[model samples]
Target: MKNILVLCTGNSCRSQMAHGYLNTFSQGKAKIYSAGIETHGLNPGAVSIMKEDHIDISNHTSNHVDEYENIDFDYIITVCDHANENCPYIPSKNAVRLHHNFFDPSKVVGSDSEIHNAFLKARNEIRSYFQAFVNEKL
Candidate 1:
C-alpha cells in the first residue's frame, strides 16, 4: 500500500479532515497519516463537521511530524500555508509534496450559525480536494 501523509500547522483540523477523506477514498490502496508542525489537539468543530458527512475523525489525535520519520511516504500533503512554508524537511526518498491553503474555521469568530458554516465550508473544500487527490493519485 502507498503511504500518504497529510500535514498542517495544527493536526487538529484541516490535516485531520484530509486524512479521513483519504482513508475513505483510497479504500485499502493507501495508508493515510496526518501530523502537524505542532500539535494543537483535535478540534471539536472538525469532529462535528466531519461526522455530519458520515466520516468520524473523533478518534484521530493531533500528532507531531517527528512521529513518522521512520516511514517512507509516497506523498506528503500540506493543508495550510504555514505548515507548507515552514515544514521541516522529511527524508522521504521519493515522496511527492503537495500543498493547499485551506481556510481555518477554528479561527473564525462569529455567531453560532456563522461559525458552523465556516466549519462546513472548510470541510467541503477539504473533502473535494482529497477526494480528487485519491482519485488521481491512489
Candidate 2:
C-alpha cells in the first residue's frame, strides 16, 4: 500500500480533512496520515463538516510532523500554501512532494451560521480537489 502524508501549519483543520478524504477514497489501497508543524488539536468545525459526509475525524489526534521523521511516505502533500513553502525536507528522495493549497476555514470569523457555512465550503472544495487528484494523479 502507498503511504501518503498530508501536512498543514496546525494539525487542526485542512490536513485532517484531507486525511479523512484520502482514507475514504483509497478504500485501503493507501495508508494515509496527517501531521502539522504544530499540533493544536482537531478543529470542531472541520469535524462537523466531515460528519455531513459520514466521515468521522473527531477521534483523530493532532500530531506533530517530528513524530514521523523515521517513517518514509510515498507522497507528502502540503494542504496550505504556507505549509507548502515551510515544510521540512524529507530524507527519502523517492518521496514525491505536492502542494494542494486549501483556504483556512479556521480563519473565518463570523456568526455561528456563517462559520459553519465556511466549513462546508472548505470541505466541498477539499473533496473536489482530492477526487480529481486521486483520479488523475495518484
Candidate 3:
C-alpha cells in the first residue's frame, strides 16, 4: 500500500478534506494522513461539508507534521502554497514531494450560508483534483 501524506498550514480545512477524499476513493490502496506546520483542530465547517458527502471526518484530529517523523511516506503532497513554502524537510530519499495548491475557504468572511458554501466549493474542487491525480498520475 502507498503511504500518502497531505500537508497544509493549519490542517483544519484543505489537507483534512484531501485526506478524507483520498482515503475514501482509494479504498485500502493508500494509507492516507494529513498534518500541518502547526496543529489546529479540525474545522466544524469542514466536518459538515464532508458529512454531506457521507464521509465522516469529525473524529479526525488535527496533527502536526512532527508526529510522522518516524514514519516514511511514498508521497508528501502540499495542499496549499503556505504549506509548500513552510514545509519542514523530511529525511527521506525516496519521498516524492508534490505541490497542489487549493484556495483557503476559511478566509472567507461572510454570512453562515456563504461561509458554508465556500467550504462546499473547496470540497468539490479538492475531490475533482484528487480524482484526476489518482487516475492520471498515480
Q: Name the candidate that leads on lDDT.
A: 1
TM-score of each: 0.98, 0.95, 0.95
Best by TM-score: 1
lDDT, candidate 3, 50-135, per-residue tens: 99999999989899999999778988999999899989987656888889889788999999999988999999999998987677
Report the Cα lDDT for residue 102, model 3: 91
- What ranges in model 1 sit over 4 Å off? none
The residue pairs found clashing in candidate 3 are: none
> How does each model score on lDDT?
0.94, 0.89, 0.90
Candidate 2, residues 1-138, lDDT tens digits: the string is 888889999989999999999989888888888999889999999999999999999999999998888878888989998888888876655788888788888999999999998999889999988888788756
**On a 0 to 1 TM-score scale, where does candidate 3 land against the true structure?**
0.95
**In candidate 1, what are the lDDT values of residues 21-57, reduced to their tens digit?**
9989998999999999999999999999999999999
Residue 63, candidate 3: Cα error in Å is 0.4
- Cα lDDT of candidate 2 equals 0.89
